[model samples]
Target: MEIRQHEWLSASPHEGFEQMRLKSRPKEPSPSLTRVGANFYSSVKQQDYSASVWLRRKDKLEHSQQKCIVIFALVCCFAILVALIFSAVDIMGEDEDGLSEKNCQNKCRIALVENIPEGLNYSENAPFHLSLFQGWMNLLNMAKKSVDIVSSHWDLNHSHPSACQMKELGVIFYNCSCLVLDLQRIFALYSSLKFKNRVPLTWSKRLYGVYDNEKKLQLQLNETKSQAFVSNSPKLFCPKNRSFDIDAIY
Candidate 1:
């Protein structure tokens, strides 16, 4: 009896208890060195990747700003270049116009007439009237196309009556245009009966009359009236009875 009981007690065949003992034991399995190293490396790689991304973004921003600044500078330079070019062209055009006018003046021919009679003051000496008349006749003969005469006291000269003949000759023979800037008083006399008494047969057929309108004539007459007594000068005259058919050429 003793021998049989002691065999089971000394070596109990319980595999479950051994398994439970192994499972319940304090297991202090430290993490693998390789695994920890891999984790640390991954974290560093993630940090490096994030830093590189930030640097790339910053570089892109800087590059865009530089491009904008360069573009602006180029535009400004182009504008300045265009302005300078236009200015140069305008200056060259003005210079060309001025040179053309100077050349025209230089090409003009001049005539020199000698043997001018001495002591021939037409204003004071009545004996020089023939010379003055001859000189004016010569000038009128020289005109081929047109003549312009400006006179303040045309009626005072006795030789001015010959001017009508010259004007008729210029208009009929040479088909020339003649313009006379006669004073208002002298013009009135020429248009009135005084002209017929002075020259009965020498009035020009192609003669044209031009004058200011009636309103302007009235105002000028008023001004003349106000100043006539103070100066005692020639009285102004407006063509009251003349025709208004011609165009206003004043």
Candidate 2:
């Protein structure tokens, strides 16, 4: 009965049963060799190929690589060899006491260079300040090369004030901008406010300690009220006071 029903489905296009059909496998499951085309491990070699030719091939490939590397190195060496030869020839040919040659040929020997700023020491013993000047003079006396100079502002002398007559010189000197001007203004204000007479004489020589060991001088100040004495050097003389102005020529 079952064979008869199945036979009818084969005769017809659709199977006789609803939503059901027999699936036909052409062959049953079985193990087979995978055919990835032969490599040494996978397939047997013919006798003509011989036992282990791969190692010899690998060695040949490495030898070719090493030969290529050597060729490349020789090419690099050749590339720089001409430049090295030229440099060596030039160095050997050069009569280098080049500095001495330059000095002699140019006839200008700038012997020493010092970065001495203006008014180096001119304080208590103002003569010490001109040591740079003295050294320069001595150098000039012995080996007189017209001195090299790099001055931005004009009149680079300070033994006397700057020699330029301009009112507003750049950066360094300005006639309106004087250090003494501030001091003058301050003194003027102090005098106008009558601070000198008005400030009480509270200070005396009562402070006592041995400040000077050699002279046996005592550090006595602001102790006694009546014995204080101030210096009387700067007496302001009328319009003549303008001589202190940095702009004053003479």
On TM-score, the leading prediction is: 1
Query: On residues 52-170, what C-alpha lDDT tens digit does candidate 1 reach at each position?
Result: 99999999999999999999999999999886666334344312113221232211121222222444234554322223445456778887775545344656454544443342211
lDDT of 2 at 198: 46
Each prediction's RMSD over C-alphas, in Å, is 21.6, 27.8
Candidate 2 pairs with clashing backbones: 204-223, 204-224, 205-224, 206-223, 207-220
What tens digits encode model 2's per-residue C-alpha lDDT throughout 1-250? 8888788767665643432444543554443332334453454655435556876788899999999999999999987887565533434321222222122221111223233444443367533222334445664675534433333356446442332222221221112112222223334433443545543222111111111112221212223222111111122321212222222222
TM-score of 1: 0.29
Best lDDT goes to which candidate?
A: 1
State residue 248's C-alpha deviation in candidate 1, in Å.
41
Candidate 2 RMSD to the real structure: 27.8
